[model samples]
Target: MSCEQVTTTYINAYYEDMEKLGVRRATLEPRATEHIADIVRLVDTLLTKGMAYRVDGDVYFQVDRYPAYGRLSKRNLDDLQAGARVDVDERKRHPMDFALWKGSRPGEPSWDSPWGPGRPGWHIECSAMAMRHLGETFDIHGGGMDLIFPHHENEIAQSCGATDKEFARYWVHNGFVQINHEKMSKSLGNFFTIREIFQQSEWPDTVTGEMMRYFLLSTHYRGPLDFSDQSLKEAKSALNGFYDLFERLNESDPSHGAADQLLQEATVRTRTAFVAAMEDDLNTPNALAALQTLRGEANKALEAGLSGEMRRMVRQEFRALGVVLGLLQTDTWRFKGQVPQRASGDAESTAKTLSDEEIAVKLAARLAAKKSKNYTLADQLRAELASHGITIEDRPDGTSRWKR
Candidate 1:
């Protein structure tokens, strides 16, 4: 596919996945760089400042002049030159000098530039787009950790050289994802695209975008992430637990017992710890640990017959933290079909969906048959439910619960 077609498909899938995961942005709508005038104007400013110059129809940035060029990545110019590929073009003033605009070849995309009919280089496009959407100085700049070397470094050098101001206040880099101890790549046969991951639905335990999002948060943002089937399964389980807790709390009656002081105290401590973790450079793993603590405390309290207020508090704690983490926002009943979860592999996909009224009638009929001492009739009703892939267990207190 062409670049425009590929980008449209990718960005649409990206926005849809983000929306399902409860992530939204004030901006990030579609944009284009078709206005060659703006790009030409930008090149004119850089050329006027003498930080950039044209040579043989190609424009290059003079890296030697930008003193703080390596401040972000902290590599000295000498060391960078030693580590970089040798540039055979002795015409360049320095080997580290990068392209700002490249003269168009036979059939490549071209735009009218002061130098000639050419195209903006990769680094220049990023700098231009950033300054266009956000001002010269913005709060944060983020990309993959691999981009720190040339892509982000060139962006900083160009943007700051033109505006003579800090480009972005904070620079955030996310770690790369490896597959089973190997770097994921198309040549390596391990690379998985956003569409590939989300489109997997044949297997009952297939990972969803929800699980993929959870797997991303399983480690720190700056830490190397390993993408494997096991990791996705674990992420699915972890995410499932949150929905499980939501369902449990929803089913329990909070009106029976008194206000649980112990549960309330746990909530405050957990929140405090969570806030501290976030302040400490967005330590998501530690913050998630704090949430697990609250989940544990809430489970223990509710299991011991805590009051409705206690359940409410527990639900509130989960809901509030979930909002911050962008998880568990969907309704619990709708998570794995319209019922509580069963201890099986992906019940939502395997089990038949049923309405609330149908479940109620089945439960009532089973109860009536059991009350009449008609074991055969009760067994038949139980077998009928099993046919629909629903599982039910009767309590000693004469109550029965069912889930699919």
Candidate 2:
């Protein structure tokens, strides 16, 4: 695939998980192919420092040259060989030394350098790209824990070994993903691609992007998320609860007095809980629960008809916390239609007879009011739209949209 295609796939997958568990966005996304210049530069510096060598067309890093090779992962060179594909290479000085640049095999992509023609080795790609984006040393570095060996460990060696500076200050590794009780295996015909899944559900293709994000984030990043029908259903239900509140709040006047106060208090608690959970290494499940609690408090206050600064406070808190969780983002709980979309064409036709446009229009109006700085009117419009299960956004770009 082209570099653009690979980056898009990575981004789509990342966003899908974020939406599901309510992560807003990342600081940056650096792709391997895009940082070829940096990789080549780093490779040259490594060679000049005697930490790397070019034999024929291939370049390899001298593992023994870095004395702290196993510091991060606590593995000896001998243990690495136990599971490594260590077929002898005549040009290689040692079996443990890995490729910095792989000499171009007939059809593969290659970039020219002092070391002949080849692409960067996979491990080096991350090291170079991450350093270029996050700097030689950054506060956090994260990836699946499965990458601890060879991949991340190698990154620490190559990046730090070349720059002679510290790499990531904190190393974060998310747990694994499995299907059912067994591991997800393609040979078992149980693998579900995002495309394949969206085709099966009534969920809009656009929303699938968010759904995948939320699903992944629903569980703590450091824990193994069990993928199954039950898990997805639970996620969907949680999503429904969140959107339901947003819809209701949109319909209720933004200046609904007491309700607004409740929203503000709930927002603080939600934010505090969420930050605490994430600070402890992105504990999403607890974060999710925190949102749910905030939701409950808001609902109680709204039902009791809260007013004044209290009502403003409640609304602000709900929106603030919801934004962090990536919930209450879109204007409507549109995924409800997604489930039924799986039905026959005739059923879809019948369902379509019930118009969503009316609600969408009202949500759009609420968004406009919010943008125009008419807080009370915006709240009133949101409340009106909520009765129809619509949600609204007065976005940073000064535009509004609705979904249901």
Candidate 3:
């Protein structure tokens, strides 16, 4: 769900995560580029108040007009100027003012605007676009902490100055992702994209999606997440053990029976612990510790040969608690098969041979049958596919795909 792609698959994944927490979905997921009209209007309003100016076909905001400019980041304006490399623009009243729109350049996207058909700058885009979707004021505005200074401060100044309304009631920022106490960077080679990490299926104890989630939430949202192969391996081991217990519970069959009173109480206690942790400004490490403690309790129950009803209750409880921390949502580890071909030089030829159209068709049929309330047909299809070592995820997007 980035700026470029807004596919139904992304929506389905979002809803899946929401369902795990039993939370209602937001009314809209507006893309910043889609709200050009709102952005243009806001920039125009800023210009009317003398808070913004147009220079070289670009609109720039007047940072000095706002007396509270440095309040958010708690830094002195003079100190900022002393440390910064101020660009001299004759049209700008002050050098600290940032651009609201950038004049069109070769190879970059552009749109029609009062500023001579240019594109909105990054900070202005969020302020205008979020206001369009969430109204002039919203309960929460969140992003990575790196955006706090200059970017968020500029957003607050522009939006509030335009609408004369409180921009956001609450501002939340997540911590950084560091590697070995050093900030991750492209030059240092510590940077790894999600796709790159997903490619490491060959190594035993290599982190999967579930383990990655656990490893990520191992630190509080306000704390730094250190990247290391050893930490990820430990997270993988922890997730594998939990999955094994879950598979066992799903396999064993028994009639409905009352779960242990203590087990039910444990469910409530675990959820309470999770909520308390999250309420304290998303302390995910404490929340994750709560999840792990519940896992231990469930393991004890399984080892004691608890009834199917008890196992089911524990399963449902864990699913609800796991979502807020963004863990235990997918079963990607089961598909730890061979890695896909890399686009070295034979990418075109490999694509022709490796595309799974036929298998995808069969999976689609099975999904269709299940959706039609044919459990018998679905079970038969699953059993048939089990022979081929392929796993299927019946997504809400009306498309079926196999992984293995």
Candidate 4:
């Protein structure tokens, strides 16, 4: 298949999966079809500086000319030459000379260039595209760890040679996702696409886009993540635990609990710990652990009759932390949309599920208790309804509404 046609087939599938998976993107920039001016401009500058040469319509970057060519990948020129693809173009003086532009071939897209009608070489594509959108220099450049050797190394050479400045402040390379014990690749028949993962029937419940993201986040970015039915199950279950805690506290009034000093101090400690973890090379594993620790501390306070205000304080703290890690963005009652049973009396009993008429009568009785200066009884009724999964909100017009 043609390269453009083959590329489009997967790009289409990519957007569809990302949309369904709730992945948000700010912009989409296609590098290949972006105007060729930037690519030609850099190549021209290199040629003027004697870093590039043309032969038989092909342009090659002289690796020996750039002293710091292998600095990014931490290798010497001789080491690269030992494994260079010298046979591809024997006309080049050095074995490690990489192509800057490839002469047009049959059945391939071509664009007018200084050397001849040709296409930008694969290595130059990123440098041209990034400089066009970002600048002569950018903050960070990242790709999979596999690209660290030649791809990223060549990009550094081209960018620096043209601009005479640092190409990127930071170079980030992430480890690959593995299937079983092996690296996921097509030749091994172990490759699995995003859609295939979503279709796996072994997921705990319904496979959601959020679940897929959660699975990816379960491992640290620097560590190799193993994908399997068992691992996915663990990720799904862990995410569900967060949702369960959110729903449990959603209806409870923050004003009801008493001893809150324990929760207040714990939340402060948790925040400090979370920030420290994030600053340490974006240690997501430790950051996620901090979130889980906060949850545990909050639940401990809940068990000890922690004040409702303190309870909400803890919830808000953890929720803010979650936002940083890109988790817990959904509604609290998302999974609880199923049939809810009434809970009442001491936060554990099967309380009476009230109908509309029953609700009106109970609200009226609770209002009477308040009028009679029975503050304790009024609060009790509110708590009773809350425990039953029914939330009573006091409206502005001195009316109460309940949702179950």
Candidate 5:
């Protein structure tokens, strides 16, 4: 495929995966190639303003023109020059000066510009795209921590030099994600894709989108996340607890008595803690912990037999707080029994847990086995159902109810 086609395919797949993970779509999606005209205009402005120079159709930004170049990256020009990765190009004015536009080569995508046939440089493309969509100055710019250096620093220098205005008011750089305490790299044989994670057969329980979402948020965004099957399992188990509480709230009567002050106090405390944690640099780990504490209090209240009104109040609070973290929003009944199908592969062929109807059938057989005094068969059936995450509660009426 062509470069543009490959990029388009990747972008479409990225958006599809984000949607599956419950992330909302961005208000605007801008591609660098689509903004070529804007990029050319910015490059022309830099050239006219003497911030950039063209050599044999190749345009390079002059770092010496922008005095505050290394302010963002917090390195001096001497240090950057010492550690520069650029080749020894005597044609450039300075070693640290970077490309604003690269002269096109044969069989490469190119556009006509004042200089010649070429394409915008990597850093200039981002600056041009952002300014085109969000004006000269925007509130925030975010990227991976690795981009804080040359990429972001160059963006600042070129953008501010051209417009004589601040480019972005805030810069937010997030940390990397590691696999099992090691850097996730293809050379290391640990690189994984979202689809691969969902279709992994290492775990008995099928990994769902929600479970992956929760696993991501469980750690602080600014900290390196150590992703593993165990971490995913922990996330899934935590969500199960929340869903279990939701199920109890749904089944409990919600119209009989006054609210309990203790439970009410717990709910209020949870809200305060949740908000405070979020405000503190989006510290999701602490926020989740606050909700977990509330979950514990909620379970206690349930065991103590809360009034219907209090139960409803607690449930509403849980949902409201959970919405902020993008958790606990699925329907309680559906979430309880929902088992996402694994992607087609050997994983898909693996044995899956029984559906609710199938579980009921097994429960009925177990009941009949007990009625016939076949204690061995009844015990075997009970063990089998338990292994599939089902719990059977036998009632005094000679019937059993099953839950997951």
Candidate 6:
């Protein structure tokens, strides 16, 4: 495929993966290629402001023009210059000076610009895209910790130099993700895609998309997240607890009696704690702990017999708080069936024995048998499913639930 086609395919796959993990779609989506005009304008502005210089068809940002060049990365110009790698091209004003535009090479896509046919540099593309969509001074700029250096620093220098304003009010750089306590790299044989994680035969239990999402949020964003089977199992167990509580709430009647003051207070406290944790640098681990505390209090209240109104209020608060973390939003009944199950024998083999659609078909057949008063067929189907490591729970309303 062409470069543009490959890029589109990757972007589409990324959106699909995000959707699978229950992530909401972004409000605005902008592509660097689509904003070539904006990029060219920014580069031209940099050139006019004497912040960038053109060499042949290539335009490079002059780091010497921006005094606060290394402020974000917190390194002195002398230090950067000392550590800079020797480049064959000696046209740049400074060793640290980076490209704003690059002349097109053979068999490469090119855009028409005042400085001849070229494309925006890697760093300039993001700055131009952000300014185009979010204005010259946006609230936040986020990326991996690796980007904090040359990429983000260059962006700050070029953007602020051109616009004469702060590029962003806040810069949030998240830490890396490790696999099995080691750096996740293809060379290390530990690199895993989202699809690979869900479908990997190494794990004994199935990994659902939501389970992966939960495992990600269980750690603080600023800290390295160590991904392992144990970590995933912990995440699965935590989600099961929340879903179990949700199931209880669903079963309870919500139209009778007054609200319990104690439960109401607990819910309020949980909300406060959840907010406090999030406000403290997006501490997801603490926020999740707060939710767990609330879950415990909610369980105690449920056992102590809460009034219908109080139960309803508690359930509403749980869902409201969960919305902030993108958790606890799925229907309890529907989600419970999706939870992974572990049983005797080979897990991979057992998991493949029954697809969700196949289970649904069997459940329908069992229901049909029961309705027709053919108890023998229904019992036989139940036994057959149980042999495949599936558990079937028949409800009073003639509905069936299965988990595996």
Query: Candidates' TM-scores?
Result: 0.82, 0.72, 0.70, 0.78, 0.89, 0.84
Q: Write the per-residue lDDT of candidate 5 for residues 158-202, one digit (tens) a residue.
A: 999999999999888888889878888999999988866755633
lDDT of 6 by residue, 257-327 (tens): 33366778888888898999999989898999999999998888776677766777777887898888788
Per-residue alpha-carbon lDDT of candidate 3 for residues 281-372, written as tens digits (9 for 90 to 100): 88888887787888887776655556777887777776777766556654434443334443323333334223355565667678878889
Candidate 6 residue 261 C-alpha distance from true site, Å: 1.8
TM-score rank order: 5, 6, 1, 4, 2, 3
Candidate 2 C-alpha lDDT tens digits along 18-126: 4444455767766677788888998998999999998878889999999999888899887877867757777788777888888898887778777777898879888
Q: Per-residue CA lDDT of candidate 1, range 170-285, in tens?
A: 98999888988788899998888755555553222222656777788879999899887788878876776676677677775634654388888988999999999988878988
TM-score of 3: 0.70
Best by TM-score: 5
lDDT of 3 at 41: 91
Please report the candidate that would top lDDT against the real structure.
5
- What is the C-alpha lDDT profile of model 4 across 100-191, one tens digit per residue? 88899887789999788999887898988888888888997878988988899999898898889889998878888998878999999998
Displacement of residue 325 (Cα, Å) in model 2 is: 2.5
Error of 3 at 38 (Å): 2.0
> Against the true structure, candidate 1 has what lDDT?
0.76
Could you tell which candidate, 4 or 6, scores higher by TM-score?
6
Question: Best to worst by lDDT, what's the order?
Answer: 5, 6, 1, 4, 3, 2
For model 5, the superposed segments whose C-alpha errors exceed 4 Å read: 201-207, 254-259, 333-353, 367-377, 389-404
lDDT, model 6, position 141: 88
